[model samples]
Target: MNTYDPAALECLAAIVEEGGFERAAQRLNVTQSAVSQRLRALEAQVGSVLIVRSRPLRPTHAGQLLLKHTKQMRLLRADLERDLQDLAPRSPGGARDEERISIAINADSIATWALDALTPLARRNLPIEIITDDQDFTQEWLRSGQVLGCVTTLKQPLRGCRVLPLGAMEYVAVASPEFAKSQLPDGLSAHNFRDVTFICFNRKDDMQAEFVARRFGLKRVSLASIFVPSSEGQVRAVAAGWGVTVVPELMAAPLIAKGLLVDLAPGFKLQIQLYWHSWNLESEVLNALAEALTHAAGQSLVA
Candidate 1:
């Protein structure tokens, strides 16, 4: 077995995190030449080019694998340190240190009930770095080791990861009362879809389009559309009568109840099943976070 150098692994991780050798050197408090040399030595030992050396440097397949290992080791070491600290005697007035856990989550969930689920962790002074993407796509972040866990639409567990269903988030097609009266007077149909504008979170978001297609039976229907990337902004834009949009039921319910927005299709709804995916590590923090999130989801989401 080939022995891996810890320093080299640290250098590789820093390079990827900082996006270049010079920046990595700055972060590692080393010279640029030193960073380059360590990477060369690591690649030689592993017999693979770990980094692509591109603008905004990227990790190769081998580099990503090693990076994943490095991150997992860091988590385990942090857990061990916390355990040891619990057993050690604390000095008077010693300040507690905060630890960070990275997670990937969908914008809709973040805008809805996910943040509430994480309130317990925040209260414990544990910092979380959230990477936001569509639930359908967050799985890629988990595969690349960018996050320790994710709330995604994918039910299949990744290798070294465990998954649990968190229930489905229901969405309703809604628009401002005025817009609904003017554009969807006859309700959502292929006839009026051409005149009605649609609001999309981003180009990658196809939920609104999918809903239109499913309800109207037009697979390739084209309508005037506006891109509003933020989850709250999407609701605000629709509420301002910019266009009709689909919003999570948890968010839309209040607006609909307040008469600020009207549900275009009352009986029809879009349901997205959410799953929590996390590294299968025996760490108290990870398990606690999962439990808190699961409990919150049970209360907030539909069965």
Candidate 2:
């Protein structure tokens, strides 16, 4: 059997996480030379270039595989520690333990309902690190081992991962009552869309454009739009009559009830089915979190 050094592997992971050699050394409480030497030795043993030497260090493909192993090892170790603690006698002055769970979620879910699902875990003192991305793209974070789990639009699980279905989140095109009256007097047709402005989450967000194309059967219609990256800010901008935008039904419901906004197309809606994807590990904490999230989704999302 070949021997591998855990400390050296840890150094590589630290470098990637910290985004620099100096920061990795500081985190490991070692000298910069020691960190360099260890990485060199590990690279030699592995016979591959593990990292790209850049201003902010990045891991090569080989390095990412090793980093995935490192992260898995850490989770297993934490599970073991928790089991051992359960067997030990309780003491008032015992060290307070907190497990770290890294997950990726879409901005819309986080802004609307996912945070409530995680509240129980937070109350139990579990430290969760959330990486936010578009739901369609969050799977990339899981594939790269940047996060152990993610809330995504992917129904198919990644290799060695399990998936749980979270119901669909509905969205509707909405505008302020005043804007709807003025800008959409002709009532939303292919020809009139050019006159209305839109609010988008970002340039990468194509949901609004997709909705328009699907509804009007007009491909590649470039309507005027302003980008507001924040979810709440997007709603606020639309409410202030900045522009019409697509918003989650849950978010728009309250405002619509109070006459703050009007549904531009009452019959047309977009529903995105979401799923929870996680590594296939027998982790109690992860299982509990998944259950909580699924239950929360059941309550908040459309079946």
RMSD of each: 3.3, 3.3
Q: How much is 223 displaced in model 1, in angstroms?
A: 4.4
| Residues 1-303 of candidate 2: C-alpha lDDT, one tens digit per residue | 446698998888778877888988898899999999999999999999999998777788888888777777767765665566557633433322113467899888998999999987665545577888778888988898767799999999999999999999999889999998988965667777778888988877887887788888876868788899878889999999998898899899899999999988888888889999998999876787799899999999988
- Measured by TM-score, the strongest candidate is 1
TM-score of every prediction relative to native: 0.87, 0.86
lDDT of 1: 0.83
Worst lDDT run of 10 residues, candidate 2, spans 90-99
Residue 118 C-alpha lDDT in model 1: 92
Task: Provide the clashing-pair count of each candidate structure.
Answer: 0, 0
Question: Stretches of candidate 1 above 4 Å error?
Answer: 21-34, 84-99, 217-223
TM-score, candidate number 1? 0.87
